[model samples]
Target: MLKKLFLVAAAAALFSGCANVMPTGGGSASDAADVAAAAERLRIAMVDPTRPALSTLVADELSYGHSGGKVDTKESFIADLLDGKSDFVTITITEQTVKVVDARTAIVRHALAADTNDSGKPGKVALKILGVWQKQGGDWKLLARQAVRAS
Candidate 1:
């Protein structure tokens, strides 16, 4: 009974705080829902790169652009997070929208505010982000992202 309860709790945790994206005559529910899941997981994974979810959440060809005009590939992005070059202390995301561009693509937009430590210096940042996510191998993967400073 305890084991069953634990499993149930774990499943709930996995699905919590994420919206189910049912089709609206333009996109697929499963695909949209998976994109939502991916976006959420990416946030968690950024603050804790030890989570294996990072590996699955991002695509091999990801191009992650920062508000400062720097861009990182998937490897560099994960490495920076893991290595403390960009250490996330706290994050709040708002105004998040997922637009399914097609069967295999999605556009995720959000406003993000985060407290971070970069190169051991503490700072705060606010930005509007646009992400391109592609469905590959039956899973949604982040392909490209660009961030613009929110004024």
Candidate 2:
């Protein structure tokens, strides 16, 4: 009888441990919100001139297109931005939509208006931009960005 009781107690303990190990759905909403916030923070960091470190928000392997052409790396892209290579660097996001693709991935679609300091003025150049973000060590980083002129 003593051995049977011990076996039952051990089985209960094993089952309880398994239950604790199972994934719970309760924190998903909070997790999604956190991901979205991280993405937004990256966007804000990119535009702040004082904080050049925010440039790291972009991944080493980023892709982007502008009035001049397409760029396939963070270094080249930043070089162009700082060099005033782009005709206009004005980017105003009118609308933004964010979707969480996974625990560490998100996609943001932004309706933007852009104009170079020289050629076209504000409101003349408009585009839609699709940005992909990935969360790494609690901070969100931009993995890719592509822009298409709005019709």
Candidate 3:
């Protein structure tokens, strides 16, 4: 009887330890909120762009896709913003949703409406954007983004 009791106690302790471990899928509420905040920061940075701010928000291997099928790397994306090649006069994001795929990754979707002055030509755009965010060292960074023209 004593041996059985020891085994039961050992099993209970092991199982309790497992309880503290996060699941491989699904994240906590705070994780979702943090991702949303990171996306908002990126939106703000895009409208009023600064090299340092944009560099911090995007990953080194960022792949940014435009509604017109053009893609930009991390360097090009920042350069265009700073150089007025791709300019955003004002931006508004709506119908935003964030899905935490895991503890370290999230998928965010939103509608982007903006007035732009790209290459000194004024224009407006409405797009549906999908962004992939990855947490690195506690801060979420945009790894990839794709945009399509809104119908």
Candidate 4:
């Protein structure tokens, strides 16, 4: 039947997407571990913001999206941290997972709980974060990140 064929095709597409997230050929476990460590370093840098550290961790084409729908480019992201507009007093990442797509790319997901003092006003946030990282030369740099409110 036509309906049955459509359903089968859709299911196949869905499973193929999942296969990418699940670990495939050519990437090793150590690659995942390295990505995790890179993510941890970025978290620490956000808490104690410094331009050098942030610039090093993020790619030139970084796209950072906040839970509130605002997006920041790499320069704006680092500038906000340096200027106290986006300040992280403390950040805790939990239930983190990293999926290495290849020797040069990875995807990371985690639950984030953070205390903030942005523009000198204190606040707290709970978010689900997805980060895409790419290996540049010898380091993994964050290429993009998106955050959504955790329900």
TM-score of each: 0.83, 0.63, 0.82, 0.83
lDDT of 4 by residue, 1-116 (tens): 69855753564344233332335355677676667767767877798778887998999999999989999999999999999999999987777777888899998888999999
lDDT of 4 at 2: 100
lDDT of 3 at 2: 100
Model 2 weakest lDDT span, ten residues long = 15-24
Per-residue lDDT of 67 in model 4:
89
Global Cα RMSD, each model: 4.0, 17.2, 15.4, 14.4
lDDT of each: 0.80, 0.57, 0.81, 0.82
Model 1 Cα lDDT, one tens digit per residue, 77-98: 9888988999998877777777
Among these predicted structures, which one has the highest lDDT?
Answer: 4
Identify the superior model by TM-score, candidate 3 or candidate 4. Answer: 4
lDDT of 3 at 128: 98
Error of 3 at 144 (Å): 0.4
Error of 3 at 6 (Å): 57
TM-score of 4: 0.83
Worst 10 residues of 3 by lDDT: 15-24
